[model samples]
Target: MSQQARIDVISGAYGRANRKIEFPKNASGKHESMSDIFGTNVFSIKKMAKSLPKPVFENFRQQLKGGHTLDKVTADAIAHAAKVWALEHNATHFTHWFQPLNDTTAEKHDSFLSLKTTFDNGLAEISALETFSGSELCQSEPDASSFPSGGMRTTFEARGYTVWDTKSPMFIQDGPHGTRVLYVPSVFISYNGEALDEKTVLLRSSSVISKAALDILNLIEPASEDHPRAQNIYTTLGTEQEYFLVDRGLYALRPDLKTTGRTLIGSLPARHQQLEDHYFGKIPTRVLAAMSEVELELAKLGVPIKTRHNEVAPCQFEAAPIFEEAMLAVDHNLITMDVMHRVAHKYKLKCLFHEKPFKGVNGSGKHCNWSLSTDRGENLLSPSSTPETNYRFLLFLVAVLKGVMDHGDLLRTTAASSSNDHRLGAQEAPPAIISVFLGSELTEVLDAIEENRAVDRAVAGTTTTQMRVQGTTLDLKVATLPKLNRDMTDRNRTSPFAFTGNKFEFRAVGSKQSPAFPVTVLNSAVASALLEIKEDLLKQMGDKAVASEEDILAVIRKYITLTKKVRFEGDNYAEEWVKEAEKRGLPNIVKSPEAFKRILAPNNAEMLTRLGVFTQAELESRFHIMNEKYAKEIIIEAQTLWGLLVQHVLPAAFSYRRELSESAAALKQIGAEAAPEMKWLAQLSPLCSDLEDISEELDQLLNEQAPIEDPEKAAEHACYKISPAIEKARELCDKVERLVADKYWPLPKYHEMFSTL
Candidate 1:
């Protein structure tokens, strides 16, 4: 049948009027005392200091801030204090929370309900010291087999250990039913010492970056009379989270959405984002209430969510927190996602973070804003005015350029995902190609350094930097330098990595993904690059008797020349860019499996291992894990399509065709012209035929159980085989939708689902 006829039938399928529900304006304001309720459940530093002995508290603080190893005695004392604080906050249960191979946080809660007997032979109480200990905090065993271990463990080997992560602090989370719970962030590992969790690798990567940063700082500013107080380097990050909030009633009616967290089959709604009024328009009353509740909940947990705004898409919105330590930022982002879902339910909304939840519209992404900072509170990525500032900025900037250039494949791997594949390279999102967008100001600096031109320090806001392409000047202007207060260049949505003032916003992260993997990759890659720069600088300055400042500047200039290929100032989505990127030798890894395969390459593994981010085994495990995830996702999607076709679409098509045939026969018996009914039957006949053919093919594919021996091949088949089946099914279902009568159609139409909101 024609596509238009099928669409018309599907459009008339749903006749019932949707029930409208009103949301409370002050649903989030139930707990009015913000300060009193905020962090009341948390075992915070303030709570710790108050609960523990002065000496024990001081020792534990040193361990947390200085990264010192806590002796067994100190660990015991710390645990005792933590138990007291948790109990005081009404936390009856404690959980060792960790991020496992699934890339989502997990926890196994244990109630503090030890059996106790008093002298009078009655059950009594246990002291705080008796309740908590180092051994208990150090390790825990959860069911490992239930998680995706990538063939690392079997059902019989259900042993997984959670080890305390001394760096991240313990906190409390408030859940439904007024339960206050204590949460300890930790790392999960197997019996053989293989890293079995995302947190373990991320923590290791952070340590590597911190060390490398310190080394670079020391090399640039050696300990001398003038240059004293060199300290540890730290990384800062902020994550911009985008999500869609649909009415819960509409969401519940859609089986595909209920199962897959996205729509599997739905034609475009006429008013969906096409009007463009929803982008930064007045927030809908229901959505605003939902956002308010989410914000209030997150703030109580100390998430520091500073910005909330309407995103480009219709029902989509974005929230961002103030920059914090990179690891903490990652934790906050995870917590925020959880909070969003929880509060969404309270406001009768469903928050969708799937990258492309709705096709034919903008997808969501988590823009990871990353930067480097010195212990002395200076942002290393921020450019300075004086020669000293300029030299330091250029040096760090070049380090980043070199990092991205050398590990472009790794960067691509960092963002590879099945959901993201549909978003990337589209006009509204970043392209698959990895390149750095250093605005006109910094681009000129790199060009000048490459050609040994005198550094331009004049206040000429519009000075043009000339290029030597057949004596053709590129007319690159040093436009009015945005002030420190206004440092961010205009955001380029199409650029995968863009410099936004003091940090690089990695815009390629899929919305549903945990930022841990990509952030860890970024930290590890930059650390390795900085280590190389430090070594090269040391080699070049040996016994030169040159000024330290001048030598540092010279080294930065040299580094710029070597790492300039990664920088771009124009549209990354342009066809011209595809050709230019190829000429520059950048890897354009378009598929998740292919991109993930790079993780196990010899050099990539070597670099990661050297930086202590991952062992060779750990790296191989991740490669297996990502490929397995991709394959499984495709399999699930394919299975969903198969079910929808067999149980829903095909049956509905046949039933509709039978009704059309009966109606045409009735008209002919009445001795009346049945042209309209005949035409309808003609359309229904072809649709029924097409649906049968597609359904048969889908059944054959499912029954054949195509040989998928390896994860990569399985994922490839999913992309090529399973995805097309889904597309074909959707096309047939949409066609049948337009022909079938409203009472006969089983699923809700797009107009009823989207327009009702």
Candidate 2:
């Protein structure tokens, strides 16, 4: 019956809608313009300007721009306008959408309808009316203990608040049966005002980094009205999301995939990504249809999904969006994941966001293209055409290098998870070691800066020369094709953190995890470094209003020397790089537990606390939560693998062996063709025994208790003991799978799952 499920999926015998999804439509049935459909469901600044009084609207705008606290009067006016806008957009209920520490979004919906008591003459009367107030919009109470607080909150003290983030806009989400709810982006905090969610820390990090950066900028160039220091600096991000599409029916058949989001035990297919033909290949028809609907849904909520294409692995694809502010970009990515999962159902597909869904192929990652920018429209990381302007870029660049060097272990912890463990250090993804790749040309430029020599301007040009003959200057490229303008630097996919063009691409982040933590760490680390640079520059100036060119150059040169060891231009996957990194005193932490231990290290904790990104208690809570989460995931995967081996795989093996033995016995009695059956049984019986032995071993490992209170110890045990046992059992299971009859195999094979769609 399980085999039949795989067959049914291959034969396209599942339920899925066949109708076309017409998005961006008007009442007259004509397709609406992108500008018209964009942000129609969102209570945006434009809507606020139209709904609120002129004075109130200006006050709200100033609060957002200036980062000032909103007064009660202003909050009431803004809340009234937002409520009216949400209702006009067909929203009947509202939800405080927040990101919890478990790498998922959470929400609780409340209706706008309310009953008001009034006296009519001598009798009491009840009237129904819609009401929304500033107090309700600004804060909401949720059970703090219900979420993963890492012992920050106990069950007895179950009180948490969701406060409105004024910067991120509120949008309406459509549900089944014409239900629509207003979603206000919020930050979750405990009763004592400790950050209980990802967004709160991210918000604090943003402010810290911006202030630190602005201080340096003010020292270099006095703030004019056009480029004022009061104007907030922002961290911009472009998240490239990668995912896989599997048939929904086939997904339901695999217990491992359903329980652990990966195939724990499956035989590698003969034709899986070996030819390298799947990358950027033609998109499957059904998958394209699903992506179209997903884009349309995102468009209504103001998500700028700009690109889609096939990724490196078969059945894997990528969806990338245009750059936006850090907070909004994280919010939109969460929305994108939700939309992809919800939309895939209509096409009988399941979107897999696991880091490594398949064992032997490439895994998925969220390539975060991160950079710093100012409200004055200047990209801090971008190099200018002239040598003078490039000095400012070099200062910012050196700050990032120093930041990454000092906090390499802490940065690795941001991407730490059991699922991500399988993906990292693989050929297709960056390794566990944290290193920066600035390409060869940028390395040379930095070298020149450190040596106090002139930088070659042509090396920093945006275009590369066309291909030519080996010994001649004549170009042999196609005459009809135009000259291509490439990026200023070559891309390095093997590095965990690489400078692509103007921004750094944090390629080690797991697809299934939230970008908030990684971004927060990155912001805090760079801010700490920037603050140091500002102090150094101030000390060198010694009461001078402006430092001389020599002083500025000396400061930049000092940083280049301090951070020189972290910049690697070689292959991160190469084994030599690991040994070399150790020689350079760089950490190469391979396990999540080791990485988590550094979160509360003296330097890391001090930086985070001093920057106001997280209190000491908050940082401690995160450490416990990450360790506990890692251990729990490993145990779950182990349990699921054990269940499959005991109930599903071993039984299949036994049935096949019994059938072979009986057939051999019957053939022997008739004196006909018994040699083949006997040989088959001989090969299958020992493997079946070995499979049972290893499964029992795995079961024992599962039963072995690590101290529950010590999460670090428990995580280490799970990583060292249970994980290896699971791998051993998987090896035995795969060996048996090759011998078992196709009809007897219970779970769907890899070939069927990868090729059917």
Candidate 3:
């Protein structure tokens, strides 16, 4: 808090202000067209065709297209082809790219060069040769003890394996060290076959849901007009990723962004999104430059990211991709974050994916647009033009509603995290309460079905070709302007689970967390629900002569009546909805830690087990893992806040107080009015004491119960006790920021961060 220290902060601010930015260009002398560079780096089916034999390439493409497995002979052939492709791209090594329990991706590279005993010149010696085999390409062994296992793996049982997931293609990763490695998408698991990674559970759930959906589709004949009865179903996903960009220099100055991925103590800036100017505003030159590089790299990797734009908050932006298979989408999103981080450094910017990097502005969310589709190109969720398809759509819709109503807590739990605690239900994001928003027309149709009454709207209100009457759309209402068309389903930004025109947008998911778990849990719950509905329809048939269509319709009607409570068409953020939700017996999970208990609930566990998504043991391990992660994150934040306040903020506050005191004494000696200095000291003096008191309280909070033996209870204690204390300390420190001289404020203010962009 010395004057010189304050001067250092001022100097840094000026230095940042004078910094000039230059945008880097592609090395090809001219910008490549999207068609020219798209998927160029990927070892795609086309690339496989070029590098592999006719029979081997056809077999590999068949396996990828239809979820079939290749034999060892074919695997060896494919591995040779992949090696040739990677080597052509300057790759010397290959790595199994996997997502661990932590927030990031993990990889361990192994060179293709292998040492072998050879007899050269009649002498036995080890000679190195570039080698690759089916076995080596198929699997990898890595130590799992250091990763978060939550008692799933012990120190003695450190053996784990990563098996190649052929469903997703392998691509070459060009690194900062000028080394290119062939990255094979893989799933990690323990030796005992327990799921140790997010992808394992996701893959299992995909199988379960595909089977469940196929069963339901089989219930109705003439499934697709062009193809036979659907053999397989896939979950389609388009994840919109939001993030913030800070200058690398300023990001280094703030230790919180480095350690926590969020600004722990910055105050709200005066000009942050209040004028509604930044949302969809023109992109900054440097940010656009970085984004262009990110897109180009991702396109080469075949991610197909299609959109990028300024977001609701200053320095915050979003990028989204076209929909892909659920599994591929998850992998693409994980790698997209990595690519963004790396590409951002080229422009001297650090990407912030934290849920709430700055307070008082809108936080980021990974709005997952999800739906179901058949292998024959039939979208199960889309509104059908014919009555037959429309009826099938209603059946699936009712089934999903039942699923969300029954397992709302579990679905909500998937998006829970310590960082998300700062975003949920804050007027910018969806409420913690899970509810379905089916536009006005669809709501009416469902009500009519439940009540056996005639609907005011058409039966298929969501279809583009409305069979009965006119539908709503956007109208500019100007003589010279063109009429803007609208989607069949209206968008409800306030709802956590909204039924968009073609897919459901889960808007509650945090920006930083991977989408694998969220997609897995949701699909699992829906599969369970669909299975239950199928059984109910079969049960209604009994030994009677009732038509199968009648039985299906009866089940749909019953479901509409059962899940009516979860269907809300009004404002979910209002207080009245909260009261109404409680009255209707809906679970409102406000805290992130509270979600773990839901995962432990008997019904939730039983449902997941029955659907083959997770065993009870796996579920318990995951629960423990989440609890430990939440508790540990809070503890670190608390510790970091203590150090930042004690070392920087309080010292700066006290130094300003000292200067005021000295000036007040000088005025008294000169017989001048010392009243202003005395008043300033009075205001600034107590802040020093209050900050010290809060810092002591925070330290005691950490020391008294640093690691509670029970992971669940420790998470609860942190949620109820430790986190609040940290916030209280931050509150005092923020107050000191306002009272201290602007020149002496040590930490970067929000204004400075938003100044450039």
lDDT of each: 0.77, 0.87, 0.85
Candidate 2 minimal-lDDT segment of 10 residues: 464-473
Off by over 4 Å in 2: 13-17, 224-230, 386-389, 456-476
Residue-level lDDT tens digits of model 1 in 6-47: 344334423323224332234566535545546554567887
- Angstrom error of the Cα, residue 710, model 3: value is 1.4
Taking all chains together, each candidate's TM-score versus the true structure is 0.89, 0.96, 0.94
Give the alpha carbon lDDT tens digit for every residue of 1-757 in model 2.
Answer: 4577667777873344454987666899888877788777788888888888998888888888765778889888887888888888788999999998999999999999999999989899999988888888999999999999989899999999999999999999999888999999999999999999999999999999999998888777765776566467899999999999998888888989999999999999888998989899998778888888998889889999999998988889999999999999999999999999999988888999999999999999998899999987789988654423366787899899999999989999999999999998889889988999986567767877877776554554323242111111234498987656545466788999999767899999999999999999999999999999988899888888876667677899899999989999898999899999999999988888889999998999999999989999999999999988999999999889989988999899999999998898898899898988888888889988888888888778777834466888889889999989888988888889998999889888988888766
Q: Which clashing pairs does model 1 show?
A: 6-735, 6-738, 7-738, 8-738, 9-737, 9-738, 9-739, 10-737, 10-738, 13-742
Candidate 1: Cα lDDT at 749: 62
Ranking by TM-score: 2, 3, 1
Global Cα lDDT for candidate 2: 0.87
Error of 2 at 180 (Å): 0.3
Task: Score candidate 3 by TM-score against the native.
Answer: 0.94
lDDT of 1 at 345: 79
For residue 274, model 3's alpha carbon misses the true position, in angstroms, by 0.7
| Candidate 3 local lDDT, 342-400, one digit each (tens) | 98887777899999998889999999999999998878887553323276788788878
Q: What number of clashing residue pairs does each candidate have, in the order they appear?
A: 10, 0, 1
Measured by lDDT, the strongest candidate is: 2
Instruction: Return the TM-score for candidate 1, rounded to 2 decimals.
Output: 0.89
